[model samples]
Target: MEDDKHSLGLRVIHWLMAIFIIGMLCSGLYMKSLPLSNEIKFNIYAIHKACGITILGLIIVRIFFRVFTYVPPLPANFSRFVINISKAVHFGLYSLMVLMPLSGYVMSSASGKQIKYFFHIPLLINQNKDLANTANELHSMLAYFIVLFIILHMLGALKHTFIGKQNIFKRMI
Candidate 1:
């Protein structure tokens, strides 16, 4: 049935966010390991900040669309346990998606660093070392949780598609 599949717009946004989030996670880790004085590291940092800001904007758009859209329900055959776990994982993913970038922006802002949109337009904020340190810690903590949630989400979909014969992956595709 048509209702089983996510809307085309939702699917597109879902895939786009997936790609961007994965890239951000990878680059963020790589950026951290590199020496601060490295030119490549600075370039990566700029790209990371720009992408984080872009992701924040996309999250706003996603919330707006989610409000007006009909989200397809999980397959009926799944156990209540599975359903509840799925809901929790979805919630975790959404929460992390919003929080990660927000904390990044807050950290940057509190550190007196102006985050330029796409490495050009300046978005300014006041500086506070205390808040910057706090936000930075929170942002760092979130990275691990987001990775866990993403893995759970993917494994669930794969299990449903291949083991359970639910074809759940097709809903988003």
Candidate 2:
């Protein structure tokens, strides 16, 4: 892989994850607004759940990949402020990516809902109503932070790519 961009494996995972996360976000929001007990709603909810579990697995792999790989350096003239924000945004994004799915799993399990991967493989985790309720609330609240961090991450990339003429996105492409 070129020093200007991410490795092919990372790029593939990054784009694949971007698409899946967007899909998961939209589906989750739609499902939350739908009336319960409807068939379509149920199906969409199931899909969302499956995707969440899949993302959890993928994120685990991604974390390992990230830990073992080297990222391209920032531009020589980049300010400390920019570099600090970059670190924070990336840290926030990774934290949310890992926590979001775990929280959802806890929420589902606590509610005594079986987690199925693609509606096939069963995920057997502990169940507790109180725990589920707590995780459910936390998951809902944590989503705001995730959205905020994602927007910040994108904005930083755009700033570097367009304004700074750094083409930082090339590293991720």
| Candidate that scores best on lDDT | 1
The TM-score of predicted model 2 comes to 0.92
* Candidate 1 residue pairs in clash (backbone atoms < 3 Å): none
In the range 36-91, model 2's lDDT, one tens digit per residue, is 87789978877878888888888887887787776677888889988998998988
**Could you tell me how far off, in angstroms, the CA of residue 147 lies in candidate 2 after the best superposition?**
1.0
Estimate the TM-score of every prediction. Answer: 0.93, 0.92
Tell me the number of clashing residue pairs for each predicted model.
0, 2
Top candidate when judged by TM-score against the true structure: 1
RMSD of 1: 1.7
User: What is the lDDT of every predicted structure here?
Assistant: 0.89, 0.82
Can you give the lDDT of residue 6 in candidate 1?
84
lDDT over C-alpha atoms for residue 20 of model 1: 98
lDDT by residue for model 1 (113-152), tens:
7677745544456788999999989999999999999999
Off by over 4 Å in 2: 118-126
